[model samples]
Target: MKQPNEKPTLKTIAQVTGLAAATVSRALNDAADISASTKERVRLAARQVGYRPNRAGLRLRTGKTRVVALVLNIEDEILGIVSPLLSGVAEVLEASEYNLVVIPETPAGDPLKPVMDVINNGMADGIILTRTQPYDLRVKVLTDRDFPFVTYGRTDMKIKHPYIDFDNEAFAYESVRRLAALGRRNLALLAPPPHLMFHRHMSDGFRRGIRDFDCMEMPLGDIDLDTPLQEVFNRGRKHFLSTHRADGIVAGSASASVALLAGLEQAGATIQADFDMVAKEPARFTEWIRPEIIAINEDIRGSGIALARTVLSIAAGHPLQSLQQVLFPSD
Candidate 1:
């Protein structure tokens, strides 16, 4: 029996259940050599004694830290999207022994460095990468090392790996088509940083939509992701005040849409009357704010779940196809 001040260990449970310490350990770990009846007895004894497996001891035995690393850019962390994504990831990881560790990267620093450190040091069993570039070096390195990793976005590089990407191109194209249908000829698109791989997809979609709809794109509306929110709003206000004011706008994100709306309101521009706007955001946000503002629901939480599952699968030695998912707005 364990004293009141002593924490319950496998040895305590083994003594209480009259089983060998090695047998108790194997049963607790669900080793194939342990019979089901013995495993049940050991589990019951562990519950009675409140025995908990030591994580450090387990790592030493299995060579697996049982941790998952999620790497994100610090700038993107401020956008208020990380919460729901994290919630989804947590929901999936809670079902297993795995735990999540977040690693934030600065804009100027090498984002791949933290990922490499985690891999080389065996700090985590797998990794989840975000804000992927067109030719991401992290993807190349991880693939070369044959480490278990999954990306939140697609890469332009030829190396095929597990990934989950939202369809920015299709969303942009549809936003333009919807605006053009409303008889808005002069249009503008608020885009992300040009260095992002998704930016290429968004730009391509916007250009194709302009050609298809026979509309003009305001050159000044190209906003980068790194630009301050207030600056984005100020730029929109200035543009709307100019003689070349666009009659319609397509914002890449809800934050961009809000900034543009604030600018338009400051300039006394009426929505749907003087101008129209469409944005990509979580469906619930647009519903709660202004139902009239057309929005394409980007499922960030779903993407998180997919990323979690992919990395876990890779870690488990399960062969999987490279996953490419694109979500559209629901009516």
Candidate 2:
């Protein structure tokens, strides 16, 4: 309905283009059934009438909001690395008509409930999931519902979809190799929790690096990767003082990386002389140092762009065959 001073709708476009309302609707939606000429006319008429397809109304007709939700599972403190991930997602969405909604995991709720809620409640057309585990519960829920999503990392579920992951194993392994190359023995790796799939990969890479390098590593290191903030720092501080002595160190996350540096300094270990620290993600605090600490930028924005585009294609009724895994190289 066009009010006295209101703009147009699909009905107005249909009238102006001399096409059926259904034809105008389908044309505006880029439906294949609508002829080419009719689509052009509807588009031009829409322009003249200042008409834009109401996404809310379209959702009612198509049973999809055409909105992609980015879910973050930040129940723990170490998982705060997801901040830059949203920046990447926002950049991609800015170039497209699609919308990005964030679904923050509640503290006490089931980890898998948000997926079901978004899909069943029609809050989103698809989702982009981060912090995927080996047997991710959210993936299972979304798959059972036949919903589309892209993961920040891979899962063990035999089914292939869209994903953008980093080479965690290679990065972890090479970090150790670099230390070994520098003649730094007694290495300690501050890794993510074993529950995370990448944790396993990184640990394997680190071990393989040491064995291949013939470091005679005791494997008596603290891998308190993903834990409470205070606990991780406490363990790192204690580990640096008493046992787990290492000349080379790898901090798996930003906070852990900074904590290890601070802990080592407090324990009378001088940087470069006693310990060479490497961070998995770019650290803010390390900027003020004499020599910048080596770090691997997660490129969360590029990963987010990949995820956003995949969800859009899926929602647009395109074949999912083009979807592929994107694995970044280790720095």
> In TM-score terms, which candidate is top?
1
Candidate 1 lDDT over 1-331, as tens digits, reads 7889999987898789888998988786657788979888887777677666676878899877878999876564433467778887888876555779998887678877998889878888899998889999999999999888988888899897888888888888998999999999898888878888888988899889999999998765546666778888888778878999888888887777877788878988889998899888854676577666788888888888888988888887877765566555544
lDDT of each: 0.81, 0.72
Q: How many residue pairs clash in each candidate?
A: 0, 2
Assess candidate 1 and give its TM-score to the true structure: 0.85
Model 2 alpha-carbon miss at residue 317, Å: 2.4
Instruction: Tell me each candidate's TM-score.
Output: 0.85, 0.80
The residue pairs in collision within model 1 are: none
Model 1, backbone clash pairs (residues 3+ apart or across chains), number: 0
Clashing pairs in 2: 88-301, 191-225
